[model samples]
Target: MANVTVVDHPLVQHKLSIMRNRETSTGGFRRLLREISLLLGYEVTRDLELTTMRIETPIEPMDAPTLEGKKLVFASVLRAGNGLLEGLLDLVPAARVAHVGLYRDHDTLQAVEYFFKAPTDLHDRLVIVVDPMLATANSAIMAIDKLKERGATNLRFLCLLAAPEGIKRFTEAHPDVPVFTAAIDRQLNELGYIIPGLGDAGDRMYGTK
Candidate 1:
């Protein structure tokens, strides 16, 4: 709770409600996620560092604010994370992208990394890890761990929905990394799915079984 920011904007809540409906089509679910992610992206990047630069305008030259340091990085955790990644990119098109390919081993609910690709200068930029659901936090935790190992210090985790069990494990594993999400659900079911969640985000977004 110390570093978590829940984006509770009306638009976000409205969109999430629609996404939760089982009747919503795959196309609709994907579209709503992209829309909600922009709102969430707004809050997640709200406190970014800004510096002024002198620039010429039609009337005169003046100091205009711009983001400082290197371009921000969006570390997407595999297929599901790509759903949120699309909107965040719409929000900041110049941001760098990273993909960490991981999938949950159902029996153990553990994360197994198969692929990883990211910018070489990770230590010089702020990394925001994105995933649609943080049910068990296994993938999220492992993704962040891999990034840190590659020299990323400033980082944040963003998700559409998170379970209390997942949040607890995540925060405990990485206290320094802040978390942002639209909602924190009651708990994770025995099978490691978020209760009352929008169901498997990857499945819903891509119409997969």
Candidate 2:
């Protein structure tokens, strides 16, 4: 609760509702996610630091605001996270990208990484980790763990939907990492899926059931 923000804009909520319907096609789902992510992106990046620099305009030269430091980095968590990545990039086109591939060990409910590639100088840039679902937080925790190991200090976790159980465990595991989501659902089902959620983000987004 200390660092979590739920984006409740009307457009986000309306698009989320459409995504919840089981009949929504894969293309439709992906489109809605793209739309909703832009709104969420705005909320999460609202406090970015800005610096003034002299610039020339049509009428005259004046001091204009620009983002400080190097371009931001967005670490997307595998397939599902990719859904949110594009929209966020649209918001910050100059941002760098990182990809992390992970899967859950069904028996242990742990996350296993198969691929990891991030940009250099992670320590100097703000890293925003994106994932569509924060179910049990195991994947989110592990993903952030990997990023921290690579010298990421300023980090944030962004998800489309989150479970209370996942949020509790995530915050406890990484208290320093603030979280942002479009909505916090009621609970996680027995299979660790968010209740009343839009369903498996990867499957719905890519039609890869």
Candidate 3:
């Protein structure tokens, strides 16, 4: 089974607490989301491959190590995912950006993809899929499925918060991909929202509601 890493960093926990409060102002919520996303991005890139090369420094010759292989592709799962993408890009400015949009049908609860754009050689790059919440796992699963269809084999999923049911479903569906989240909440409600989650991530991020 794929591993689901819940970041226990104090900074992540603190920002998440502020985001969860009902009284948190719109500005605060947005800022906190960006900050938390940056922190989570740090953890997600911990195992990035590195290679060493000899370099001549001002003082002396030295062997320096740098990242190896093709650059990463930060694939955002549409509107809500944009909230996480901004911070992640701050850390990996060289990474390519891709967008995939999926909407859940209110009646059928099925994931419907509306948009997708990715690098031509997706299989060679490390693809990190970002979204603010993992609720029912329908959208995340569908988004990843689309990536696989496009030849994306090296992939990871990042989220600010996740529900247990969503995590289970995601791991079961893609055991090869790992998941990183700031926190794991309880379960999804009937409406397919993570229980005690920060409401609708898209709505909160954009102050839509």
Candidate 4:
């Protein structure tokens, strides 16, 4: 639990509950994901460093606090991660964005990357990885591995929901990376789905399934 943070804001829970309903429409699920992501963003970025800057107020000049360091990077794990990325982007329009596309190999349940495009200054930026669900964590693990290979150091992870098994594996694989999620559902099922989860996030958000 030391490496994980569960965001228990009331609005986050309410929106997440709606998303879990089996009857929620694709449009509704996506809308709620975007909405809840803003609330989660609040906690995930709470510790962003700030430094004083010369500023001019209506009354007089002042030293105002502004974000310090490289432009923040939001690295989304393809499709499902895109849903969560929308709201965070709204919160920080100046932040850079990255997409890491990965698909699970059916036979081995392993992640395979098909696409990866990120900012060149990853080493100097604070990267926040987003994915709607951290079920098996194969995608997240591989995504982080690739990010590190590219020079990313300061990093955090954000998700809407997580499974205990996934969290265990993720923390063990990268204890330095902190995780933030709106909810931690029950254990994963035999088929690798989070129990009591909002179903397949990509399918629900895109109506693909």
Task: Judge candidate 3 at residue 1 and give its lDDT.
Answer: 27
For candidate 2, the per-residue lDDT at 63 reads 96
Model 3 lDDT tens row, 22-124: 8898888888888888899989999999998999999999989999999999999998999899999888899999899988897877889999999999999
- Model 2 Cα lDDT, one tens digit per residue, 182-202: 899999988888998888899
Q: What order do you get sorting by lDDT, best first?
A: 1, 4, 2, 3
Lowest lDDT 10-residue stretch of candidate 4? 103-112
lDDT of each: 0.95, 0.93, 0.91, 0.95
What's model 4's TM-score?
Answer: 0.98
Candidate 2: regions farther than 4 A off: none
Runs in model 4 lying further than 4 Å from the true structure: none
Between the candidate structures 3 and 4, which one is better when assessed by TM-score?
4
TM-score order, best first, reads 1, 4, 2, 3
Query: For residues 1-209, could you state the per-residue lDDT of candidate 4 as single tens digits?
Result: 89999999898999999999999999999999999999999999999999999988999999999999878999999989999999999999899999999988867889999999999989999999999999999999999999999999999999999999999999999999999999999999988889999889999999997
Instruction: Give the Cα error of residue 178 in candidate 1, in Å.
Output: 0.6
User: Candidates' TM-scores?
Assistant: 0.98, 0.98, 0.96, 0.98
Question: How well does candidate 3 match the true structure in TM-score terms?
Answer: 0.96
